[model samples]
Target: MPSTILRRAACLLVVLAVLAALQACSSGDSKTGAAVLNPSTLSSTIPVTRAACTPFGAAPSVVQAALDGALNPSCEPGGEKLERWADSDGTMRDACLFEPAAASTAHPLPLLIYLHPSLVGTDLSLDVTNIRSQLETADLSGDPDRPGFIMLAPYGRVGTRYYPLPDQDYSPGWDNWYRQMLPDGQERRVNGTTYAANVDAAAIDHYLQLVLAQGKVDRRRIYIMGWSNGSAMATLYALNRPQIAAAAVYSSPDPFGAFNDPCVQQPVVGKPKDDTELQLLNPQLPIYHMHNACDIAGLCPNSLQLRDSLASAGATLIDDHIIDASLKDVAQCNALCGTDPLANYAGLDAPGGYAANLPGYAIGTVNHLRWPSSRTVDLFDFLRDHPKP
Candidate 1:
């Protein structure tokens, strides 16, 4: 990497401070409260080395043991740091962890491992992204007085990416785990750093086990919500670890992978040719996939292939969440079909209904929708519906 780029990376904290100041100005309450970093800006900052992630100079074992009982699950809001692991390089890595205060020992709580989306941008850094909103709104259970939840949100990369793209370095060892294998063999780490779909998944597993050992968690209820690249990561994780309650993925690219189409210069869309391993894991694992009719990158052509493949591999229910809109701009869309063009299509399956709805004069792009309306599809309710049954 160039000296300029390294310097830029090192200046992450400065960027964070600027963002913090800007956020303070925007919120109008400069001195009070904290930053509000949702799924979009979570990638604003990140730890350079794995060791730097471990706070306080604690060893991995020490960190794990100290954090095992760090949380108290409860209906009332409460949380704590789960774990901090430092690699041998003395280069530490940090993480984002939040848990609702312990409700009661007798009433174990559910755990929701939330994965933020990826922002393919310049340098990565740990910012003053005030996570107050995340802390308050992390619980999607919909019951204010309901049992609490354990929400773990891992940071995505602004420099590299959350999931493997056509351009990033992915290890060959992850071939079976990740269906999107590159033609040029596996992806190698740059400077001993391995960033792949499984990397985040593995971290989730480690922290989840720590909480599980505490015995205050309900092993039966563990859910995951992933958007964009995070969606790909969550789906890939569920393939092997089916026991993760119910999962909801949003803004997923077409076929089996990719952020932009022609990924890595070649589009790796549709299901994998060899999914014998996925078939053995838990064919009945039903995952919910929501996307736009005309997807982004190059996933538009065979967007439904992922859903179809998952069904063939053993998913019982693949709920199709599609955002139906004309390929034209807002003006053009309204001129041809009028406002609420998709309102007429009730409970329409994405691939089919969306295709049939296109006007004869349609000309433009039709990609993924922001989200399937909660009235039509509530992913949170879906998660609650499945509890390790």
Candidate 2:
């Protein structure tokens, strides 16, 4: 084999190994939460259809190889298949697409655009939660014609240009205007770092266009969801594209420049700052947001700011909550709380993972990092009701 191919293969393997290790450590055991719902429990079923997708642009040999192993349209029935599309700039971007077995051209299904968490790429995102299967089962339980929806979970690029924290290395994550911008509208980063612009939104738009052209999607029911960093991306996308019917997110940070800092508890402005660049958010778009009460000190308060700002802006259908810490899954929280430095400050005492009982913070496990299996049905239930008006 050529040296270049050898080098590429080596690099890919290392990256995969690191990602696998991270998943093993962070995701915890599968049985930590509620049991996954069985599709057999539902009365409806979708017939499996063989699906196929073609690559739009030429990808590096490493990415192409991964795609070969991960995406096989000919055999996959109701599973996710990876595909690469060319950006306007001709760079290849990857996304894992999921189509239910019952999806047909005659009856279009809803389209779901899921943005993954930071450092968690497209592949790991699917495994992060059983929400995907729960959603599929929920869709199947409904009308037969619209048995399931097509999901597109796109991979984010790692770069200092988009998110530049001096203490953290660049990893896969979505771009956020509030997190990256300073009070004066300049990029927030170390002085010498090379700052770049946004391509994630454009890439997402391209992905949506590709799926829409397939004629198997119902444009009116398009919805988006995100976790952590991706939540900000989902919010920004819903704001920009009125075509999006609704948005659902978990533990999202403040996207309106209010309480953007994890260490700082105060808003950047005098009050909950909503008049930033994302102030143009449409008030009519339905938004469902849920935050963990024992999350990072700033995040739960940030959720409040997000909720209040949007509500004050005349957003009619907004649902926000700060789930009590006692209601969280102790096992899952125990697995995740150790990884976050702020977990102790939240007074999380989820067996083997907390210290210091801080007053005013919730007293229990830290449910901020992991997706509790208990809420999957509720989240999808909300998305199912509100289609674009």
Candidate 3:
């Protein structure tokens, strides 16, 4: 062949190789194709993974002690109190409240309200011992003052999930709602409401009001954190109440349709259910989401999309941590594994804790990476910077 013909052929081969390389990255490796996060100047993200070993060990006492240290001198760890408040019908609801030593009416403090997961075993209250244990390992506790913060973990009224509504469920709104049992044996209905009063939203609201009344709450710094289904509910609750400063969610998909908990619902009939509504209430609401590439729930994709949308709309901040576990695939990630579960595995290995060995992560397990991936970033530290205006 002529020299000109040879040059043209070589260029064609180079183009093909580049195209092939691009295809490989988009499959599931790179957060490029279908990525919901916007790389614009407004929003930013820094990916980080959990520690090398399981921070929460097999021993319950050890885990508790570790959590105690994480919260530090302001509050003694391992101790929890059950707070009971009146429901709409004048009945009582129970939740676990954690108070730092600095919590006093004279000096206001930030409040962190946590919602439990969708799955419920024998216990109906927040999995403080387990989930919060992870937070301890991550050192992701609140700090309103020098070394203190306020945390409230509320139990779910139906199916152990935060039923989305600003108040307790009444007859007309939940009048036509249906009822059924969630896979985890909790009773629930997604038609907005049912027999069970939705104190998840209402109860938390009432508690906030009570705290405000007590004059110990720094109203501008109030926030919420939830995992799995509860994470979705966090956004739902934020939609109704714009006063909430920020939200930190994990495992729940960013997009509205990642995982379907037909039972987890919005109790208010005419209330806003989509992003359009969320934007109207709080334009600069800061949200930090932990999404794993290995999630069995298929929540990462939508979560990324939502992150982008939020950034585009001028959100105060969107910390989208996309975890990538190359070896853990859809089937492998979703397997009935966990024989060697890591720190604070809640499903099968609980109360007693799990084997320190990992990779055989907990059921519905996704990427094990939690917390900000960068060595310099700390979630708890970042949270303190943003106080509501």
TM of each candidate vs. truth:
0.50, 0.60, 0.50
Q: How big is the RMSD of model 2?
A: 21.0
Winner of 1 and 2 under TM-score? 2
lDDT of 3 by residue, 1-389 (tens): 69999999999999998999886655331111111211132112211122221111010101122321222111224435456666544434455567656668775677777765544311332333343443323333344233455776655443221122211121111111121101111223222322232334565665555556666667777777766555665755554356677787765544222222222221222222421222123445677766565453233454555665555555545776655454322322222222111112223313232343233234224342232234213444555666665
* Lowest lDDT block of 10, candidate 3: 53-62
Q: What's the lDDT for candidate 1?
A: 0.41
Question: Which ranges in model 1 have alpha carbons more than 4 Å from their true place?
Answer: 1-81, 86-93, 120-145, 156-197, 259-280, 298-303, 325-377
Q: Using lDDT as the measure, name the better of candidate 1 and candidate 3.
A: 3
User: Model 1: how large is the Cα RMSD against the reference?
Assistant: 21.6
TM-score of 2: 0.60
Candidate 2, residue 94: lDDT? 71
Q: What lDDT score belongs to each candidate, Candidate 1 first?
A: 0.41, 0.53, 0.43
State in Å the error of residue 310, model 3: 4.4
- Root-mean-square deviation (CA) per prediction: 21.6, 21.0, 21.2
Candidate 2 clashing pairs, residues 3+ apart or interchain = none
Model 2 off-target regions past 4 Å?
A: 1-82, 86-91, 140-145, 161-167, 178-197, 258-281, 326-366
Model 2 over residues 154-178: C-alpha lDDT tens digits?
Answer: 7665532122122022456655542
